[model samples]
Target chain A: MSARPRDPMLPRSYRIESVESELPGGEVFSWTLRPRGGELEVGQPGQFNMLYQLGIGEVPISISALGEDGTLIHTIRDVGGVTRNMAALSAGEEIGVRGPFGTAWPVAAAEGHDVLLVAGGIGLAPLRPVIHHVLANRERYRRIFLLYGTRQPADILFRKELERWRGRFDIDVAVTVDRADASWRGDVGVVTRLIERGGFDPRNSIAMVCGPEVMMRFAVMSLERRGVPARQIYLSMERNMQCAVGYCGHCQYGGHFICKDGPVFPYDRLEPLFDVREL
Target chain B: MDDLAQVFAEEPFFSGFSDAQLRRLAGLARPEVYQNGRYLIRQNGSADRFMLITTGHVVLKAFVPQRGMVPLETLGPGDPLGWSWLAPPYKWHYDGRALERTEVIAFEAEGLRQAMEQDHELGYRLQKRMIEVIAHRLQAARLQSLDLYGNPAGDLP
Candidate 1:
């Protein structure tokens, strides 16, 4: 029997065009990818792309931004083998790309409601597109509150855009770090502390959060205690995903696949899974 | 009961219980011994009681044909072994096997439930204690996941 073609869900080819460090500590890195055809499947906010460097294997990386031209953008932290290789890729080097999978942020539902975006450390990557979309169509939403936290000021990703977002009238941005540096003058504590100071109206707001699972859990609890309905609290989950198509069981949590059913899920639907460790 | 109080005091779940309350709780606990490789509870079996290890180790294993009896976690002295007894659908979620000759104090769930129902203040205190135990375990699990799957981010040696 003729062997079936390799699944289309797997990327055929990828070329890294350039790399840059947005943060001083060299922990968080960004890359510009040049696909062979100079084209990529357009993805919505909160979806992620599976990136593979030849011989190194694959990882799920959120597409950080949509360029005015067509180049896809990714912001990655140097945390693992595949990522370490990805950060080292020079211009014209080959990599692989798959997906642009998982549910996107509820940008449509978020329209007309006050939007509260919470991110910690590299958690900001998944929320980047939503932030861009809201700012690009600024009048669609009432108010936008962005609460971000990192281990330290130096660990914050997209520092430049954070400044720009801070300047916008409708966007109220608060940044906190676990430890403050000499040049940093902002609140310091857990990210939940920033949420307390932001004073969001949970009744009319839809809150989107992405971070370490513990932080997300705490943020969800804080939001719920402050009156945000579980349905209105959305979370972006990070799990090991070998196949973006949901065939691999690596990303299964309860009945949902983190690669297919989420990356973003309504908090209420995910409550049971949250309680079970290693799900 | 007083003899068991020292064991209870050393357990993380009961550490928060006052010496007096823990002594009182020990009154209701019954010590049981198991040989190495014995099954303490089987997955999907009835969960009529909760167990707190006093000595030796137990392995919480879940059956998977691909990897028979995948060891999920190891519980040593002081860890509460079953959470199923707390709520209905009271069936053991995973198989528990004695990794070594083990001794544990088994607390009858129905008895504790009755005791709590009879005393609102005690119920609230015990419930609060259980919540703390659950939270601590959840935190440890999350940290373990980060260590296994997360980027070390310069924190690792």
Candidate 2:
């Protein structure tokens, strides 16, 4: 670590190596940055990048996947103008990138404890890194559980990978859908219901939850009720983040700047402000 | 066969009940097996019994005017299904169907009702559990209606 502040504000040119459509409106972009003429820095999982769409605007998107050969993956859902444009991007196109900013999941802290990673819908994107990290070093952690809930079967991201992970004996993967058609023979309900049958030792467990605010609130409540300490539970928050640094006031939460301070914070620190509604 | 008392003790719905109370509950339950596609309970049907599933899967669904049967939840072992038996008029709100061959213990509503009436203490305990179930379901239904994941927009609570 140098105090050099490497490429803080300058935009790097990342060539989109591949683009894959997920579900109906979602897409995943794989990029290999050639900043001036070199490789882009490897970003830690749970971190985000400021992606610039030239004339449109820049949006902070989380690092969804990391390639073994050093590529950055971003999963985008077409919600607004920037995201819609991101979805329309084709392979070989180049996008401007600012950084892999903000804090990351507490992977080290979760070691030795049962790791429960819970995600809902597109919320799974951010937590994908944690999944990769845990699986890569499976021996360090205790039981690794992933409880994911999506809107429906078609809406599930990383479908092939989820199936692969589910097949593993060392990991516990429980997926539920909000609604199911006749074809879906899997579990159906809110994700929290899975916790009742999840069988994790709450006292020695660390839970990471990411999803809609309402969904996250309920997940946190369930974990808390099961005797998991508020300190050990973590939540990846959703907010309007601009600048991806502390310079702009766009993503301020009470006193914290989500861009620099956190997108991942312990439930104990955020308990007071978790769902204040007016905040 | 799964021991009845042990099975009853494991359900979260009956987690804190005393062993004596749990034994009485186990005694009241009648074991039944259902094949796939069987309707354990139907909407608007008389809810004369509630079921505690020990093995296999059951789906809770509601039929909309145009949407046929909309699956709400697929419950598995250790789940308590149908609280409508405790409420007035006693009609099932949703259809409970076995998606696969299933094993469950059906608790007779009339017998339990009579037992409760005879023993006010038992009635109070059972009523407390039913109220908890109703409140929990109300909260779940409210969350479902929010449809938070269906149409997601960023930058808002």
Candidate 3:
């Protein structure tokens, strides 16, 4: 039998058009990338893209939002080596991309139901695409609720978008901070408290959450306690992803590979992995 | 009046407080228990409360798939669990799990904030104490990291 050829590391090439500091806070950085020549794959909300910094390394970053001009947007924090290198890249630089990987947000399934979006810190990057998709097809859903939490007032990502979402009648947005300075006048508690204050009918709502593992678990627990079914809740997970493809074991959580099986997974699928800690 | 009071009074952070202040602080805190493997604070979750370990040990863990639950540090009596509660965006930086059956005295963050608002002197004292605790932990972590990556000290006993 003939052996299958190994997949190439450079799956697709992307051109960086612009980089913008989306949040006034020092944490979030937004970048615009356009595929060179070839058409980019259409991605679902909650899906992620693996970005490689030419000479540095590749890291899995969630697609923040899609632009009307065909450019894919990514919101990243300058945390690790790969992201730090990415932040230093100027406009017109080229980077590598692997996929529009993982199962997307249940946008189609969520039609006709109220949708709740919960995000913490950099977790907002993954949930932003879902929000855009929901708002674009606004007529399909009954109501949309967004709850976001950050470490401090200055660290809130997507400040402009958050304000715009707050202005819209179709979506109710609530934000909280774990700690706040004198400038902050909003709720000064955990994001879970915002969910309690939002008063959504969990029975009729599908909740999507992204953030650090701890925040996602607590958010899901809070939602479940409010009557939201585990099956209806979706969570975006973060893991050290080497190959965007399933071949690498870096992103594995129990039996599932976060890169291939999901960066987005139903809450029930996450249950067994929750206590595993390392997943 | 309670086991928690006895433990709280002995903590280094409470050493400077007068007996009356210590009693008041104890009154503002509540004792809680956790079984082995229970999470006290989850990574990236809101850190709206602060906990002081009274008995047993808890592991400060960070999940990195390759190495599993990377034990960042093992904390025991007198250590504070959530420093983020002292600063804004009070989100937990990492997950804290009880390595054994543990008891803790948790101070409600909002109540502390309210108390701070009423008494600046008490607030300053507490904040200074908390900062010192954070500094000590950071130094300990740095030292541990050095031990992990530093040159070997030859011919150990």
CA lDDT of every candidate: 0.78, 0.83, 0.77
- Candidate 3 lDDT, A214-256, residue by residue in tens: 6676678678867899999998876767786788797788998
Cα lDDT tens digits for candidate 3, B59-99: 66666776665555556666677788878888898888886
In model 2, state the lDDT of residue A43. Answer: 82
Q: State the lDDT at B37 in candidate 3.
A: 79
Top DockQ model: 2
Q: Sum up the clashes in candidate 1.
A: 0
What is the TM-score (0 to 1) of chain A in model 3? Answer: 0.94
Model 2 chain A weakest lDDT span, ten residues long: A27-36
**TM-score for all models, in order of appearance:** 0.64, 0.93, 0.63
Q: Per-residue CA lDDT of candidate 1, range B84-147, in tens?
A: 8888888998988887899999988888878788877667888897786677556544533342
lDDT of 2 by residue, A1-279 (tens): 656656678778888877777676454333333444577677887888888877777888888888877678887766777877777777777888888898889999999999999998888999998999999999999999999998888888888899999999999998989888767778888888777665899999999998988999999888987888999999888688877778878888888888888899988888888767776
Better of 1 and 2 by TM-score: 2
Error of 2 at A121 (Å): 1.1
lDDT of 3 at A237: 77
Superposed model 1: Cα runs more than 4 Å off: A1-7, B1-157
Off by over 4 Å in 3: A1-8, A24-27, B1-157
